[model samples]
Target: MDHNISKHISGNFNQELENVRNHVLAMGGLVEQQLNSALDAVNDSNAELAKKVEHGDYKVNAMEVSIDEECTRIIAKRQPAASDLRLVVAIAKTIADLERIGDEARRIAKVALESTAKDQQGLLGNIDNMGRHVSQMLHDVLDAFARMDAEAAFRVHKEDAKVDREYEALTRQIMTYMMEDPRSIPKVMDLVWSVRSLERIGDRCQNIAEYVIYFVKGKDIRHTSQDDIERDIIGK
Candidate 1:
């Protein structure tokens, strides 16, 4: 009877942990959707869509608060240690990243709403491509978190470099456009801000990937070199 009671308690604790994790993932999904919608608004020059994205940020913020509270409750009630402790810490940190990503998305939407540039000028296409890359990075990192796959997280970390390069290239192009035509400066400046936001989103995704590694290996690999991170995860 004692063993049965102990087992039941353990099962309940595990369920609580799972619930918190699911909430974090759900929050990530909402942030991803918000980002995609913001990007679409930029591409289509749709103020209505931008407004919708802005409004959706509230839901993301609420999810962050909910998941955070649940994590705190589990930690206090269950007194989890070892791997379970790591899991909760990771979920908390990842949710923070997700919230910041939502902020970046909201900023992008604001830029879209303010932008008056209707001409494609090929800049929108470039921005769209960059947005798609970062979006995929977010999706992949979230999948890694769901599966707790350190290898997958590492792969996503590597992809961030490509996003950085794309951001730099886009900035250079926008600068050139502004110089060639001063009348385009205001619109190009808005595009620059949007690009910067997308770049920051990539950085946030990489941070989540680091959290995945931390959760899996009990190592904080935030500032570690790429080669070292690869060695650490692969060696394990």
Candidate 2:
């Protein structure tokens, strides 16, 4: 390739990378909005809000497609090597995670529709808190990814345990309620599913945090002891 043409190709690849980043952020933003709407639907028991979430999922799906196509073009044309290759793969996987997270939010909205219990009836113990915490975790993970901040990502990872504890506490309460009044089982069960969906969202946030660390540091950082990751993350 001629020198000027080589420079032009390099510019084009960088622009493509930027496009990939923008698309991922767009997907993340949609998922974030979905989470908020899901929680609102649960609190208000509004079927319309739930329906909106289900339909808005298409935007997240399309963002993933656009990002995938651009990433594929760059991979085949530029053949990003070494660190660049790793970044491409990380971006792809992160987009997948975000899309899955959106699916879980839609599921929560579905459960909201099935529920007959009012948000203020105390039928779903501590779930309001759970929704807030899990949503904040998602926000933090995406912020970490946008800034490439490994430290912030690790903080989000550590917060997952807190969300789990909250979920478990809520579960025990629901079990106690079910035992005290057998007739309440059907109505209370929907709360169980909604809270469970929030817990799953927390788990996905942890996965997103791990991916952020991977992309920022080019490290796997998966299924390892926390101490080991902290030790290596600092060194890197």
Candidate 3:
């Protein structure tokens, strides 16, 4: 219902477009699982799980390549116009963002592999909380995409601010740890990088939310203020 692909004269064309959309959702699900596992690996200091996450990055990359090819084929074969074209373009952009998010997840998992001492586990608590917040954002944005709901996408866009605040707080905490005992600087820095990855993942999720708005509303809301995004979505 969200997509108007059924309006096409050729049933095959409709099925092709539907297939592309479904593949994108499948890729999103894979990225979500990767992110959650990476966060768990960090929280539990499970090096084996972290390694699995790292190895799984190749699968995400492969999915991106495969989806990009499918989109290109659709554009060439169907010559889709208007909203159909917008849907394909948005799918392309969304997959690219999802691929980057996977890379960030891999980076976060590496932190667990490098710094898993018992003393440093205390710092992971905040990261765990922030990770959950970001994970929910990704999940919600993907749901918005599934429905082509601009309002839901805008709401997810607003959530990036909260993630930013959490990142700032975590940075301060890491700095405190470093200043209190210079000996822990190296290990603390590793945690800092993991927090940074989570922050970047939040940013990537926001980008995908923007893509959803672009597809549904036919407006590019990137680099716009939150108030402007709300007005644009609501006005439509």
Best by lDDT: 3
* TM-scores of all candidate predictions against the true structure: 0.92, 0.89, 0.94
Regions of candidate 2 where Cα sits further than 4 Å from its true position? 1-12, 118-120
Which candidate ranks first by TM-score, i.e. highest?
3
Tens-digit lDDT track for model 2 on 37-71?
98888777789999999999988888888888888
Instruction: Please report, in order, the local distance difference test score of every candidate based on alpha carbons.
Output: 0.86, 0.81, 0.87
What is residue 229's positional error in candidate 1, in angstroms? 1.3
- lDDT string for model 1 (47-107, tens) is 9999999999999999999898998888888898777788888899999999999999998
> Which pairs, if any, clash in model 1?
none
Ranking of models by lDDT? 3, 1, 2
lDDT of 1: 0.86
